[model samples]
Target: MQFRHSLTRCSAAAAVVLLGLAPGLPAAAASSSTIGVAAGANLEGISVYDTADVLNDEKIKDALSSIDFNEPTKVAVFSRQGEYSDDINSETLAFAREEHPEWISQDAEDYGDYWADGYFIITLSVEGHGDGQIGTYFGEDRKVSTSQMESIHEAGYEDFNLSRWTDGVIAVGAKGAKIMNRPWYKNPALWITTGVAGGAAGATGLVVLGVRASRRKEFEANLSTGREHLSNVTMDLDTTELSARTLPTGSRHAADLERRFADFMAKYRTLFARQQELEAATKKTRSSGSGVALSKDFIDTAQQLDATDDAIIAAAALYTRSATWQEAWRAQTAPILEDLAELPELLGGPDKKLGPAGSALRSFADTAQQEVQAVGTDLAAQVIDVDTALDRLSELRKQLTERLDAYAAARIGAYAKSEAEEKQMRAKLRKQRYASTGTRSGGSILDVTSPAEFFWRVSAFNIGYQSAVKAVNSSRQAASSSSGVSTGYSGGGSFSGAGGSSRF
Candidate 1:
């Protein structure tokens, strides 16, 4: 029986070997991130080499040697000091090609099958700060991506900056191992290389898995709709701007924004365009009663659109206060602090009221409070502009809100009599949050863009609260509010090699 099971895995691995016969367009990308510190990881049996002598090499190796990597990937660190350039990305790829040609994938389509052949190559070019300065290279067998590379780079940000080079090495290795390791089921060659009886079951499972894919896809539809409605009012906002020309520049901006917003509601009645069409479609969708089931397509699209809608409404409110200056800053800043202020209610002190997750949430909350306060100081001192302050605050809001919502749901879920109820409740929370954005539009981008008021509102829409809640520097947008695709590779690979780079 054990042999049969192993055979089953081999068969799947064999089948998966054929997955990438189609050509994969090569890509190179990276991003920047800076967060507080965390502890280092153990890298016992892994092969690590420091091609560039930065000092304390043996010490780095010794600390990492504490943990065993049975898959034990080889790691090579390449360091140099210079200005930021695209060369770092290409240079890392070149090092792998020249020194470790054996590591490149024999097949062009290889994506994480031969794990043992993978290498984590870190290229550190210091005397540089922010993004794309720290480069990473992964062997074809290892298959790291742009997003994963960024996470790995971020893992070592603190240690790397302090020139605790080895500690930085250990941090990245631990992170890479954690990210690279996957279940045996992932190896297609392992599952299908053996025989027939197991192959049928495996194939069937793959097909069934494809049936109801993708909450992200669903979320996208809604976000796309919101963008359409916003764009529609572009000209109207433009007109408002023109009308305000008689006023002084700052006053014109203030008058223009106010007029644009008023026109938005007066013309279309709150974010929707062609109200009659939407009402007509609603009546058509309903059968004999008021209750109508939303299609999966409709639900996903609405969710994403609403997230954008919330950002817009939140922006509008803040824009209104933009002229009020201090009040606008307060509006931009208060929600996150208010949310953090409630942490103790859920935390219940050191006793762990919500279990391990609760404790974890509180720890993050504390960090968030300090950061928010610090930013507030910066804003008051004029050390940072309002846009910059909003960028910082927006990121904090996304992180806290997502976590708080989850913790709140978990608190509610705790009372459910069954596991199914808990899951259902979680889904209900997400669905309701996505749907709550009050973006009632049934038209396409073109349809919504038809009105003169539409053009104008979208024109001024760029002004206010948008940046306050959408941090430009975040690694990736939070899932609850982001309009990105659900998952997978973020899909970029280099023709030169498989790995991508990230900033430290």
Candidate 2:
């Protein structure tokens, strides 16, 4: 049963600002450094094995959201239908079979969904089928569903469970990793998938680069360290401006500027603590389910903070440039500017000579004066740059708070619209479920009393019960091939082998 949901756009700003990432203002002094190389780019492959139960589990779905296989990441996403044991007997099985004739049976009662594009493996007796455990096995051991899960645990990885669908998928990916990590000849499946195994019929397989939990942890730590360093550098620059303002004219020196920078560096340790606090607060707000207002406030505040931090970092760069100019003026250029002031006096004095030395001296004075003035102008400009960045950060923080307030005011209307959408979705699902299954009469499939419903259900059962099951190519054929055409994995299979090899 397919539920077509029409989510009326009640508030575009609410939709865009709340659902998507808040619009970000680039940090005035933001560096062009990449956050970190995404591991997904180097991922060998990805596979999603969804047992029927997983479709109804929201937590599992949310966990799987981060692993996108459709993009150009090295990880190929494979969608596979996994089997779960339900206590439906022969009559129910026969009815379901009659409805979708193309689906094959893995056991006396278990139905297998087939697809041509990817590797498929049938694993029966997966640990939780009767007794709750997790494993997968291939070839002759394919009947043993627990084979894969057990092998993974035996290899020192964590035990797999259907509840952690994402983890199970990762485990399946590790099998591909073991294959892909091998030498070329040893990985014929990769050769075939990448078009190297020409005319090889059974070479369809995936090359997964499964990231271990440890690697993910390490990547996160490295990312956090990078952010901290960046924030500290920004704060250091801001503090340098404070000292720069206090420096008397002609007293500025490279040593003094560096000393101030060093002082700020000492003070930088506490900024990391503040950052961690903000992160903790944001996480708490998200987990609390405090509605859109709180969530939006946290997001807006976090963005503003990030912008402020970047500006501070940018200011530091500008401040450093200013300090360099200040140092040059005090050490060398100040003397030139002073000498240029005396040039008019020297030229007007009684002993003024029109010799080469006198002409050279006038020329030197002229050039030195310009250089000194240029250095002053450059330094002033850098100061402005730092001040402007700081000002922008202040303004951005103010704007975000105001925007969040407005969003909160309008949140009630948005919630009402969303509730209406949900109601419509539920109504559609109810209509389809009862219309197709005929009201779950007497809590038994054999007891369906409506002649019209019975005939339609029986027709669906007939289609699914066919013995010789093959991959149906067209959408039309696939529709009749399943009991509830759009309810499960109908028209969802695409070619790109991702799991254990399946021979049709």
Candidate 3:
């Protein structure tokens, strides 16, 4: 009875030791839960088999069938026992001895002292005997540390209790819960927040820039427009002043003056015809000695008529060259009238009444010749004055028109360039906004700082335009003054000569 009691105590102690080392067991043996083997606690006095020997251990497989291997198993076996009894089967003992020959005389030292402190023990038993052969299997020095072993033991206990078993096999393995963690770059929320913020900031900056650009463009456009208008006004004023300066003063009256001069010539020709008729009548009356006095009168009258005819021809030549023949007539007519009034008196006489009559006729002829010479000189002078005035007026008109036209064209071109530049700036601003935010903006696109700056630019352009206009006006005025003085002088000289000739 005492022997049986000792066997039971040994079995219980062995079971406790086996239980402690169970987490380190082979998978096949560890899966069987219906075996009659004792698994020990604390792994005390346990023997472990080599990996090769344990794989071929048939007795280990049979013993595992009777125990609850679903629970973590730990085993402790003694290498030495008291004298053998008949109940201890010789065949099993002999088989264990043959398989584990080195286990027979091994020292029973503390497993922790033999190996590292955290190393667990494994035992190979034959037929449920306490006197089983023991061998030690070293724990992995690189992987299995004391702290890791403790953690495994704790996890095993929890898993064994919670898991189900089927046909003596554990449903779950211990390694299932030992995985690795996730990295930081895969967080969608972080990337999303960054992208949104960056996009918003970029868009806002673009919008502000665009607004400023647009305002600048508008200001430039207005400035250009103002300049153009001012230039146009200036050109128009210049043209007007120029035209006034160049216009002929008496051009409209020229034709009428010419007609009056022609009528005066016709009258003079009639007087010449009357003198010829009187000479013919006197020649007929003087056919005998008594006719000698009549012959003298006729001969003198004929010479006077010839002089009158010569004066009329000179007058006609002056009228042909004058721009306004009426002016020519005025200058010539007074001289011709003076000669005619002196003619009859200069002819009054003393001689044979015939000699007196002959002297009277000769006097009339001399007076007529002087009058004709005076009329010719007056007509030539007046005609030359009229022609000079017309020529100067024509040249002035052409120069003024050309200058005004060129100024207008320049102003228009400048306006066009300014407008084009404004448009280009606006387009560039729009492109910048789109590139920054992937959207279009609805405001000005330029960078303008102040209203004052905007207005100043516009005012400057206006001033420039006004200045150009003033310059053109000044130029035209100068042309008018210089050209007008020259024309006036030339016309005055020509008219003066005509007046002097008229007095001859």
Candidate 4:
């Protein structure tokens, strides 16, 4: 069985070889009136012949017509001495010499008279043929081997055939015809059979390859799109959230809060300074209040202190709503409470050695202590509220970050996919170009087969369409978000008649 299989394989190979060797059917035969010429060059008793009869033959002429021959065609022939007669035509020889000046003659005696016998060579130059010209030569004697002649013919024929096809001719050879017409020959036909099977198989293969490439590209594009969307979302979310944290609820509200606090602090410091100054002034004044208006200065200082205390309370209320102040209060509450607790011990110590004005200095120290304690208590209560607010804000921020991160990741994926799809598209474009003959209606040099350009055009169109859809959706979302109303205070002021202030 094994030997039989081997024999079968050998027979198949032989059949294929024979099929290849068989002469292809000729198209139209050459006109009988078509003139054919033969020429030869002889030197040092060595002769070479050129003939046109083989080129003018029906099959040869048809093959030549399909090609564009722009260069001269050359061929070599080998034969024994009896193949040529003693009679030689000088006219044809002269024509050969005139037309092909580059034809060289070598001394046969130098090579032991190897190719000294008669040999006839044929060269064909078809006018207007750009690259296809067939030539054959037969020697008059056994000067050159048969292999040499076969080699020359094969080379010339192959060159002529390739050139014709390359020049944009749709000429079909025997192999092409068989492949196009036979369906059972294809491997797939073993399982699936149908009419137009060959063409269908070719087309299906092409489409399958194209679709596979397109799908790969789309997958890459989708990944890239996801990534980019994720990135954009992350960035936008970060920006908005950070802005919400940093930017005061309103411009005027922030400025007013700062201004009021600063003014109150300044007045409090001034009052304290004035009290010292008043003590010094009292010491410098005569027994009767003469050098300065003591009553007026004291009254002015008292009134300033009263006004500043009012402002401090108002500013503290406004500061309670601020995110920054809330954060600060939460962080500093413990330290502030400690400071307040230690103040009484420091103030009540025997070191209550008030400078010259003893009784009045003692009274001022006691008052200041009480005021600091009250302020501390109020601040501690407010810190609890601030901590609660901060907790909520932190939770909100975490949620936003997670959302943005997911979005950014998705966007990055999308961007990468888009880029990959582009590459796949490029490859598909190349395949498309190779599959088709990119010739225009007219015979123009502009005709081109470029897969790159085709892929780029297709990929670009898809990318643009997808991007437009995304843009529209994004626009709608933005419009919807913008439709709601948001209300906040313009500046630091009380919402009610009683001292209640809201600050962003």
Q: What local distance difference test score does each model get?
A: 0.48, 0.34, 0.32, 0.33
What TM-score quantifies how close candidate 2 is to the native fold?
0.17
lDDT of 1 at 358: 72
Backbone clashes (count) for model 2: 30
Worst 10 residues of 4 by lDDT: 495-504
Against the true structure, whose lDDT is highest?
A: 1
* Rank by lDDT (best first): 1, 2, 4, 3
Angstrom error of the Cα, residue 337, model 3: value is 65
TM-score (all chains, Cα) for each model: 0.33, 0.17, 0.13, 0.17
Q: Model 3's lDDT to the true fold?
A: 0.32
Q: Scored by Cα lDDT, where does model 4 land? A: 0.33
User: Which parts of model 3 have CA positions greater than 4 angstroms off?
Assistant: 1-190, 238-504
- Model 2, span 243-265: residue lDDT tens: 44543333223233334344444
Clashes of each: 46, 30, 38, 49
Of 1 and 4, the candidate ranking higher by TM-score? 1
